[model samples]
Target: MIAEQPKTNTAASKAMAKPLKRGRACMTCRILKIKCDGVRPICGPCRKNPKEEECEFSDGPTRSRTKVLEETVSRLEARLQELEHPDETTPSVTLHDPYSPYHDSRQLSKHPSTLLMPDSRLFTPLSPFSPTSATSSLPSGRQWTSFGLEAKSDSVTSSGSSSSPHGHHASSPFLGEEEPSFGIIQNLVDNFLPHASEFGFFLNTNRFRHATLLPLPFGHHSRPSRSLLSAVYLWGAHLSQSELLLAQEHTLMIRALQHTATDIMGPHPDAVLHTLQAEVLLAYYLFQTGRFLEAKTHAATAVSLALAAGFHKIRTSNLHPQPMIGLSSETPISLHPPHDNIEEGERINGFWTVLMLHKYLTIALEPPTSVCGTLEAPGTQIDTPWPLDITNYSEGLLHPDVRGSNTIRNFLVNIPEQGYQGQSVLAMNAKAAILFHRSAQLSGQWTPNLQPREFQSFAAVFQSLNRLIETLRHSLTPLAQLDVKNPYTRTIVLTHALTDAATIKLHSIFSYSDSSSKQHCLTSARNMLAFAGFNIQDVGYLNPIIGTLWMTACHVFIDEISRLRSMHTAWPPNTEGSEDELMERLRSGMAVLNTLSDESSLGKYQLTKIQEAFSAI
Candidate 1:
């Protein structure tokens, strides 16, 4: 056996037995002064006896821990400075202030007043149905004239001599501009009153009319403020087809802005209530005109004002502070309880109006930055009941006893409470708005890497919202059962549209991956189309936000069309009929958008986008 075995190479045996030197040591090995195999990510020594600390390597020379900490602190300090002094380091655009008298040619050039003066292209002369066409072609003799001024004078005169009893025409900047004649004011009132509620005007119409149309001393304390009147005139001019009224839109808008701002700061008896109404009207006007940022600003301002005025806690009982906190709650200095049930109703409606606008903008804008600062406040609580008809308030029908803490938060969590009227049309709209906002938040926060428990929580909330939406839709008055002549008919139809839109939004995130979600989106899209079909003639009068809902439905139809087209391509023409129905539904959606586009810039924008998407396919 010894003779058969080949002599081993002594050099190779020594080479194999010698340990190779590692180029670097992992942090763990280096800290322990142990030999390392230098494996990347996880070194062999660390892997063999793994601990909670992860293995890491430094290509350069190792630094002291204190030095590393110092560098990190310096970086954080620099970042904090950047954040604290952003205006100094970053160039920013200042929003145009309509209230400022310093607006000059240079200022106008820097920031054009798109909110008041729309794009000329959007109001082309060639388009017969263009929003500006009626105003643009006014007869030479017909003109909007200022109080105590000649029709030929375009400039606003600051004359102290005026017939108004309050001297409002002389002292108030709101009335300093051109004032419509009595006949023109009446005409505008006629034009705006029918659609007032549609735009969140909660004042009693007859009271508003009587107060505003009176000779001089607008006697009642509840009379509309100069600012509120100006806002009403602005909306009236905006909605009017009269050449004279339309010509005054810009002047009325300027006056409204100035008046509303002044009224908020002034000591008017009903400043809070009137200013809230003015702000809401201005916000809706801006939104319809496609000035979304301005709309959001005004809406947020309304919400702030509402909160400050305690509008959210209307009819709420002052609760005693819990003993655990060891502090007594201060008795809120309540404003004299609303003068009457009508006034109380206005407060309730006002809170919901602003809340709806806030929620809608939260979903519609979906700003990249956090909205916690603007859209909400700490301990922001709402206990206001749902709104009822102004007539209901007049008849002494008020919301029953409140049974819940946070009306909205409780609804979101599906917490059952007694005596809450959740079935009213206005209440349903508010609920839909909440669902719309929550759906956006949920879909935005979703990620594939979410933990199982986190995902379960998300899914639970999503399902709960879905159930709520379904419940809301089922609880609504059937379209067939609604009185066509009743003004509330439009509201019912719109609420139905809103619920379907909410469903689409909630399911949109899972549309591609989940079959059930895709079906839900399609069904909702179809339902919205049906709603529009029934209300085609009145589509122009629906809330401008409905344009956004139309666009939402259009998205679902577009996706389905694209999917069907792809299937047809992949399967050799057999899927041709599959997309026909979807294309028709898409066209119906576009038709409603087109009807709205005549007056609303938002609608025009949505129509343009849908057209582009369809063309791409």
Candidate 2:
């Protein structure tokens, strides 16, 4: 037996000496920097602490989730610092706590997490390419209760300078006694409130009215935030039909914006939602007043503030049954405010309004300078759900039984019954805008890149767009289509016109020699002209993009007509639209341009271009 044992198994020893290929560490161990025996659903550490369910493992040897989150936090901290101390050369560092004037960079370095709320985990960065997978990392646990930074006191004053510590300059225009009288405030609301929603302004009229009753602490006035109140009155003055109000609209707007600018200098502007609201209204005012750059800047700031407040993510009221290891067993924890339906509805509406504005801005800012864009443009990614109707949300309806989904992305991914619910006018317009954006992107790339992959991609997208158009068309009822008196009529007309514009752009990409593509382009151009032709006077005022759509259609029509004429077809061919019909369409498009030529310099420039093209044909 001893002689047989002496013969060692070298293969077994070698196998034992080899290192084990360990799986990626779970999220819990990665955060704690401890070794993890990787397991499914529950890792070794998470298994011991059942409440650590957020523990997840990567598929490969990639950076752990904790590291990614830490990096994101670091970036955000830098961004916040930059926003607070825009002029970094200034000696007085902006501290979060208004009570304490002393600056301490050491505090931020020692406890960086202090600036982050307990539920900071919810601020997970999402990739545009993998949006669905991005959501998996954002496991809900607790409601975000803290503002994550100290609140600036109203009474605090900065040292070494006459400027107030609340972050206002000594010479701030808001410090003046230029307050609007009660009559002026009432007049402004009367003029603005009725037409506000028509242009995608989502400020709650009831809330504004209530705010007007609250007296300011600093002055004997019946208004809470002077800046916000001024903005309301300013917009009212601009929209006022009264000659007196219109004469002072510019001065009022400048004064209102000056008051709002002071609020921006505060320690943490994003902490207060009302500040964001004021910024948005100001942005809209700037837009209507033809101040594009300033409006865009204000809108961008509002979007950043909204994102900081986590408004892009859908807020739900349901509680997580799995409590953390230390929380009380009897009492459940809530992450969001309970029974605040109005605030929730406002967030929903606000997010979508900004998203739509961003899309409009992008279309406007794109090349070809004559085209006018939407009033407000936010340079931020939008991942919010489609806003429900005001009635449904205001009535305390948490969720509704929709056909397919709630999010705009999901709606596009899987077309809902008849595009979307007919009642949701906002959703309809958003979908149409999405299609138009895709068309613009596709056209931009088509000419430069003639690669096989590009063609294949465009072909696939174009086909999908056609299906979406069909779905949109089916969603509209005969009654809705013809109801010219309804406010929603403008939305419907613009949506259809944009859809046809997108179609024309897509079809125009194909070779002009290709008979089928040329015919499709001609048909789409005709459809766009027809859609925009109805109530042309009203459409121009409803949206600024109508002129661009008309111009695009005219170009397509002219190109097709020129092609047909070159082929020696004297009579109007039955295969294509008649020459007389094409000519009529062209004339109708010109009429719209001529009508809007005096509205702005852009309008006049667009009309000139169209006439030149028409004369050449």
Candidate 3:
């Protein structure tokens, strides 16, 4: 033993004697001027001395101080330059494929031209004093363009006419208090009508087109109200690819808002009905542009108008006539009968559309309070039949034999009703909307420590809603069976996507504790992604509400990724591939959202939120 000890390992002793170097010192150790072994949670010296102050490592600067100073100086220079040469500082707009794989996610997230940019100038409302007030100061011969819209230097007058400074008649008029020129109006109509249904346009398209496109001398009853017409024009400008029309967007918006206010207050044959339509459109427009509070206010107004107009109690031979409740005794009801089946069908569709919008707003905005307490409540009961397509109304294919009261409630409770079965796309969407709202509300009400009775009640409703969602999903027209060329194909695809989204929402609350629930959510999320893929190719514009659905699905993937990462310090070779697959799916979802962001401010907001969430992991 003595002989062995004589041969000491000098290298090992030397290595042990040298102290390990640390990146930074803890605050307490630095203050105490003691040798500190840097460690997370608690350092070695602090651990040895039980009474020592808690160890806290300062979060030092992420970038070098010199680098930060340089960035600050550069930003100041840019600001000074912009102020000195404001006219020359106008940013150039560029167009690119949002879904292209070559584009860097981090770069896109920080792009100055993105809708999420912090510059107030990007979203400034054009002053109502002049149609071109916002664009008037642009340098001559320099044009501002976006979204495939070419720019022009045509000057617009405050009056209802438009002309270039060179005295040339402009192609489009500056929309003012007066009605727009026939060609301008027609162009707006063409841009809006094709995608009308994508929003909540429940009126008959043929009737709307006839009323709007026809010149004056048509009967007042046959023509659209100023409110409705203005709203349509607003949407047209909002959706147009023409820079001329796009320039008038704010003008149209202001005109629409003013007309809607005036028409709702004035006494006209179609005041209540047309204003109702306008309010819905305005609400949707406001929502797409990130005016959530205004959107919610307009939505509530639409609901009130629908109720006042007696749209909730549309009369038919088979349905019992019910007096509207929740109205003050002084409130007057519209007792006049609809002129024809088309008018009557509009009322029916109108109610469903109002209900769907209300529910969607509730889900998307998650307002602190709802207009009507719940879909199943007595005051909110829907007696109107499920909506039939405009074509069905024209063909006299109405569901005259179907009864109405508690229509939505019966469906929710799993009670079979003749009218609720084998429904059309519009009807199915209405049904899905109810289920979607119910599931979201129920999930919010969930608690781990529910009393026995409460638990039982909650379980029963959950099971019923789950079964109904599955049934509705199966009843949907399959994507493969749809005619791709038909415009209605988009509607069908939307319904399917909505159903799948509902399933994920329904199971989301239980996903953490129940494996089956987790799998169900995962399956639904994957299906929604597939639908998104189809939508990207076939559908030109998506309703902004779909952004909520996409966000919900993204949450499912995010939760899954977090769970797998927590399971092991390093992923097993076998499971690593699956984790990468989930990440890919998440990226695909984000790409779809990015594409939507190009057209919608809400989509941009959602995409930014999801990017932040993914980056946190």
User: Which whole-number lDDT from 0 to 100 does residue 394 have in model 2?
Assistant: 72
Error of model 2, residue 311, in angstroms: 1.7
Worst 10 residues of 1 by lDDT: 121-130
Model 2 over residues 156-212: C-alpha lDDT tens digits? 223211121122322222232233334555667777766566455665667757656
Better of 1 and 2 by TM-score: 1
Worst lDDT run of 10 residues, candidate 3, spans 119-128
Clashing pairs in 2: 143-335, 158-165
| Ranking of predictions according to lDDT | 3, 1, 2
- Compared with the true structure, all predictions reach lDDT values of 0.68, 0.57, 0.70
lDDT of candidate 3? 0.70
- Kindly report which residue pairs in candidate 3 clash with one another: none
Query: Which regions in candidate 2 have their CA more than 4 angstroms from the true location?
Result: 1-175, 209-227, 264-272, 281-290, 316-339, 368-383, 400-406, 415-423, 478-482, 514-524, 529-540, 561-569, 572-579, 597-602, 612-617
Candidate 2: worst-modelled 10 consecutive residues by lDDT: 138-147
The Cα error of candidate 1 at residue 445, in Å, is 1.3
Query: How does model 1 score by TM-score?
Result: 0.69
lDDT of 2 at 472: 70
Best by lDDT: 3
